[model samples]
Target: MLMMFWQLTIDANDPARLARFWGQVLGYQPAPPESDTTWWAHYRGRLGGRDAFDDRIFDPDGRKPPLWFQEVPESKAGKNRLHLDLYPTARDDSLPYDRRVEIVDAKVAELVELGANVRRRERGDSYYFVVMHDPEGNEFCVS
Candidate 1:
């Protein structure tokens, strides 16, 4: 049997807050008819299936799967060995590089207000991206 990609889990000090932030950023809705203690959400897209993402926020106790955000005692330190890179889904070859940079810049400002810190920024002749950290200092990139 072939195994498919399930989800991307994150360890966070504040699971609920981080889950909510990511949900909004990814345009996902909270799992319907929510239950207590297990905060779940999903995003619908064409990549994997109608429900491509199954994210959850759980207490320190370990349970469930598919992007579970469990509470941790120690804080995140140093650089992230793994990170996410996001791109514009609606991008077309028609737009110029400067326009793309402007669009991504606006997104960076919005994410910063949503508890992300800019780590670095770079622009090329045809592309641009920004490295940012989540509220808990986990690194992710926006392109």
Candidate 2:
């Protein structure tokens, strides 16, 4: 049997810019083309301008899935159905709730300075997370 690796593709108004922003947020970097033909050309017949890439980023530590941002002219209109939850403390059970909260807050502040906005914070029995919108208005959480 064979396994196929997958990449999370994101639609973006400014693909390269969004990729850079996410790179800063996740400590990821631009990923090189995986193959000599890293593009798909089928759309060229119907959508001539479509390219295989807008931008792509990958975790240097190889711990997270690669992200590929594709350019789209349409602006985001509704809330995203899928989103990411970032665990700043690496999801360590030993970290106290307060400590995790503090770390999450710090990360939120940093992201804000880099062009993200907080939507709100949520509390649970033993959890705390801040829902935020990325520079391109994609929703995600930090905890």
Candidate 3:
């Protein structure tokens, strides 16, 4: 059988709020309200309303995998084994290296204004990327 990829789920103290943060960061939107309502009902029924928190953000173009946040009591304690790498350029591969760097730096600054913290920046002979943490400390890269 062929394998299928679905959503990427993350643990958060506040699923809805975290989802909103990631939604803005990725230019995504809340998974359609009808879809979310159905899922929420199912979750609440299955869990007896005890641990029924779930929120999802979807790419506006329906291309990228949806991101899910589920409420959890425990906090993130360490770095992520897997992290997202974002390319802020809008399919503009023809941009010069310096311009690409400028775009990336501008995006990093914008994300910082939206509550992300810059961890570090890596500059190579041919490329550069910035490591940053989300509001809840999840590390992601921007290039």
Instruction: Tell me the tens digit of each residue's lDDT in model 1 across 45-139.
Output: 22244322244522222233335567888789888889877675256557777778877889989899888899999877776889998888899
Please name the candidate that would achieve the greatest TM-score relative to the true structure: 2
Better model by TM-score, 2 or 3?
A: 2
Ranking by TM-score: 2, 3, 1
Off by over 4 Å in 1: 1-5, 32-66, 89-91
Clashing pairs in 3: none
- For candidate 2, the per-residue lDDT at 95 reads 90
TM-score between model 1 and native: 0.70
| Cα lDDT listed for each candidate | 0.66, 0.79, 0.79
- Which pairs, if any, clash in model 2? none
Q: What's the true lDDT of residue 11 in model 2? A: 94
| Whole-model alpha-carbon lDDT for candidate 1 | 0.66
Q: TM-score per candidate, in order?
A: 0.70, 0.79, 0.77
- How do the residues 1-143 of candidate 3 rate in per-residue lDDT, one tens digit apiece? 74365679899888887887888888877643334444434434654444333387777665567778988999999889989889987647688889989999999999998889999999987778999999999999998
